[model samples]
Target: MGRINGENRDVVFEELWKLKIPAKSSVFAWRLIKDRLPKKLNLRRGQVVVNGTLCPFCSNNEEEAAHLFFNCSKILPLWWESLSWINIVIELPQNPRDHFLQHGNGNVGGIKSTRWKCW
Candidate 1:
């Protein structure tokens, strides 16, 4: 939520809201960027009881948003599919905010860039 490594939050949000996607998708992205989603780790932080905190997909690590979405062994292939469209692949940042920003880096500008951000 605060400035990320000096990157302005307003600019990041401005770009985020400009994507041609559904409002619910935008809301989901906003929650993801802000770490507000109810991932298992987040739920535990609020003292909400659940059956378990391990990732439901991989069952190998805590189900944090960053891990579930960006680093999970079960989810990486889906991310790779999208990255392959750009003909590039790079190490993804663990933080959701950083991952969102970096996911679209080095992309061509205009609609393509918009699509990348949306993805």
Candidate 2:
């Protein structure tokens, strides 16, 4: 692989290995990073009917990866509460890549670092 592509893939593999979430959860996270999750917008783009393209949680805007995961009116509070319980304060990024990266990349170590990884 080219240098840049290899480096990017390395980062992804590193993150996936570091996240101590369940196997299914880690797989879900991997799909999220690849932008391969079958969100409503993705389905729509694939010519699949979704009734409405708006976000199911907020129903305020088009259903997309970033909005569904981080920017929705409903899910953000839950995410914040979960992270806040562990003493991590976060403002969800509008960008999808940034949002995924914001999850458990702290410098801490051992059990605490494992605990800090996203669900």
Candidate 3:
């Protein structure tokens, strides 16, 4: 018995060479992105909705990622103040995974803090 070539492995590899994501962190990230509850609640398709519709913070139809992260009255000011303190401007990603991954990095302490505050 030997390994076969051209196998479509859907499982994520533990080591990605230079990416160096911790195993727990990688699993948590995947769960955040792949979980079905958010999709069902948000009415997104295949956990990959990108019509720039529906707010991530609130379930409003017109609320895109940008609005949710930087324009919505409920979350905008808090995020703005946090970014101002850090002196960085992150362009919100259309995909929830990208947005979460980018901010999940240790450098974005403010973002992490804000997430906690929200929860």
CA-lDDT, candidates in order = 0.82, 0.73, 0.50
Runs in model 2 with CA error above 4 Å? 3-8, 103-105, 108-110
What would the per-residue lDDT of candidate 2 be over residues 15-88, giving only the tens digit for each residue?
67676578898888778777889988788889997898888777898988878887788888888898788887
In terms of TM-score, which candidate is strongest? 1
Model 3 segments more than 4 A misplaced: 1-29, 38-59, 62-73, 103-119
The window of 10 residues in a row where model 3 has the poorest summed lDDT is 9-18
For model 3, residues 15-109, the per-residue Cα lDDT tens digits are: 21113456665555555445423433354555764556556567664654445444566786786777787666766555544555555455444
Q: For candidate 2, list the clashing residue pairs, or say none.
A: none
Sort the candidates on TM-score, descending order. Answer: 1, 2, 3
lDDT of 1 by residue, 26-65 (tens): 9999999888999878888899998899999999998889
Candidate 2 structure lDDT: 0.73
Between candidates 1 and 3, the lDDT winner? 1
Give me the displacement of residue 105 in model 2, in angstroms.
4.8
Winner on TM-score (1 vs 2): 1
